[model samples]
Target: MLVIGTTEAAYMLGINCQRVRQLLAERRVKGAYKDGREWKIPLYKKMVDIIPGTRGPKGRWRHRLQARPTYIHVNKHIIDSNRNRRENQPVIKVDRAKHSKYCHEVEITGPCRVVYRPHQPLCSGAVLWIEVEQSTRVITKLYG
Candidate 1:
């Protein structure tokens, strides 16, 4: 399983470290443990993406961005792979106010990986991100 530190979990969860620990303790997040020096948790990159936000897959992360955006999505079947979907979609962080439709806080069965790429107002009618699924780790890229 992929393990992450408290800081990383907090960053992905879009909250402070304290909150992350609380979530872990409460079992809101699965596979979390307290290390001798600190707490560690199993963080699936995809989980963070489903958290309702406009920040593209990178900004949500506290640290640096990965070479390619990485995260998992449970709604893989829902994605229409027949057409040229978001496969080569570029990621950008966006403001929730800008794209309320996609930015709304929605509940998901599990965390699915998604990159936050805020679309430029000049580029289109709304500010949203292009989502794509990572089939394998080799093809997937972790954000921060």
Candidate 2:
């Protein structure tokens, strides 16, 4: 019988090293025995079993939200300044059909108008709006 340490046994069984020691102490592993300080496990023996629970797949433990493109409206002055900036930030695309719902939601009025734009590094189920003013530019709260 090929013998291996607790760490190797844990790796073979897809479990923690401490769990392998625990299993040894509990006498769960058929051919596992303690030699001095180290626990030796037989390679061919049935050492461990996966416990049933609510965990999903290996990589997809949590669900991710879907993202969609958004549009925003800005003043001519602000738009001009943005164009002149060095960063070359993403320009707000004008999509009347897509942004109609969000346009009414922001309630565009006065000298300032509301526009919608999809956030950079797109987030799930939400979008950002850039509210440009004469002296300052502000990013509005995320809306889902």
Candidate 3:
């Protein structure tokens, strides 16, 4: 076990020299002692064994991104209208329900197929239907 200074410890730990000194003062780093003005920290086999500090709680920033629309409303008439449209088709937002009980507005885009007749004005628990096309390579691999 070789002994190193604060600068070398900071480099190995991927932290600033000031933070390393602060950790030494807080007695967080094990087997580290102050010799007059300089501090000598003992090198360990792994970085995890060098410092045993408790981590902070997980952040809630990712929860914001996970927040989705309560309802996903897909209309047959809207898809029919855009069937002949160009590549850059504008997404239409549904505000009022014409056939279903749900009236909460939600934006819907892309092609969709009706799997079941009862799944009108889809809610959180509803099964969504999205149309997809099989590529030439995938078709050959499966059926060729």
Candidate 4:
């Protein structure tokens, strides 16, 4: 029944004196009682268990467009124009209304180049252009 001060208890437990005071306030340390101006703890009693600190930031990680794979959005008018230009080309039609909150990743099997064009009066209202080599296949994946 050896009574020890908060600083001595903290030294024995390899923790800060403030942490010992906190444990005493929470009544987590066994056989520990508060005196007039200090906390007295038994030498044989164990300290409160320590919880592991969180590794990353405080909140959940946010999703960013640059972090994920690139995606392109094409409207119905663009698809119609592309179909008119190339008769034998296969056009993948994506519903703009249904996928308003999502982005589609277009994966081309062979050599391909993705071009982004800003809205201009001279050029057609197409924002994204995907140029693929001959005999290449394109696959589209949707992600919200």
Ranking by lDDT: 4, 3, 2, 1
Q: Which portions of model 2 show Cα errors greater than 4 Å?
A: 45-144
Candidate with better lDDT, 1 vs 4: 4
lDDT of 3 by residue, 9-57 (tens): 6644545678777778878778888889988887666331244456775
Q: For each candidate in the order shown, give its overall lDDT on alpha carbons.
A: 0.41, 0.44, 0.45, 0.49
- Residues 16-102 of candidate 2 have per-residue lDDT tens digits of 678667657767676677899987776543333332234555421111111222335433444576567743333333332123221
User: How does candidate 1 fare on TM-score?
Assistant: 0.33
Residue range 1-144, candidate 4, lDDT tens digits: 577787656544544678778767867677777789977777543332332335644422111111213233455654577578863333443222113222345566667676676753213355675555432434556543
Tell me how far the alpha carbon of residue 19 in candidate 4 is from the true structure, in angstroms, after superposition.
0.8
Q: Which pairs clash inside model 4?
A: none
Best model number under TM-score = 3
Residue 113 in model 2: lDDT: 42
> Considering TM-score, where higher is better, how would the candidates rank from best to worst?
3, 1, 2, 4
Tens-digit lDDT track of model 1 for 1-144: 677687655545445777666555666556666778776666565443223234435333333223333322222222344234645322332222122121112333333444445554323433333332222211222233
The TM-scores, one per candidate, come to 0.33, 0.32, 0.35, 0.31
Candidate 2: residue 30 Cα off by (Å): 1.0
